[model samples]
Target: MDPAAEAARRLEADPSMLLCGPLSVLHAVLDVVVRAYGEAAETVRAALDRLEDRVLAALACRPHRGHPLPGARGP
Candidate 1:
């Protein structure tokens, strides 16, 4: 984001996190694309989105170890 516009955009849009605007735009495009593919496609797309979100959550929670993340520990 352009630094100059950041303040103004934040004031007007009031995004909860810095990612809200971009994620909102992506969500719109995804909605259209998924709806076009019908119910089964929508289900698959939602599942993929959920999985992607989980992966992102995991990545965000852990520290990056040696550039690539370390392997998960065994139970």
Candidate 2:
């Protein structure tokens, strides 16, 4: 059941227990939001790890040549 609807049902069932029902609903929603954020963080972390690995591999395959600055003395 939807969180809002469930909370409404609780409120309607007992009008006097005002704070308790709504607080429970709020807690449930926050829990879902937090979990979603955690999943997103993990996804971004994996993507960055893959990008770093690809970049390092590409750099390793290239031959190193020191390019002297223009008009500067070369050894």
Candidate 3:
């Protein structure tokens, strides 16, 4: 599954757990910081931040460089 889909599955499977993990510590600190600086916004900026690196690293992809298919062009 794709990263977005996986994340959605995670959120659906266990929302509280997804948001309440150790990552929540950083989120909580951001929440406090936002409140402190009085930033106005509909959603937390952190949510907009891309966690793609961590997410993708967790979901390792299949390597496809060496195993070329039959009739495939060669360099």
- Top model by TM-score, which number? 2
Q: Candidate 1 on 1-75: residue-level lDDT in tens?
A: 333344455444745543676765555455545555687687899999999999999999998775444785644
| Each prediction's whole-model lDDT (CA) | 0.64, 0.74, 0.57
TM-score each candidate: 0.38, 0.61, 0.25
List, residue by residue over 1-75, the lDDT tens digit for candidate 3: 243444555556656845677675445455555664554353446544556666776667645458778999979
The TM-score that candidate 2 achieves is 0.61
Question: What TM-score, to 2 decimals, does candidate 1 have?
Answer: 0.38
Clashes of each: 0, 0, 0
- The regions of model 1 sitting more than 4 angstroms off are 1-37, 68-75
After TM-score superposition, the amount by which residue 40's alpha carbon in candidate 3 deviates from its true location, in angstroms, is 12
Please list the residue runs of candidate 3 whose C-alpha ends up more than 4 Å from where it truly belongs after superposition: 1-19, 39-75
Q: Which model is ahead, 1 or 3, in terms of lDDT?
A: 1
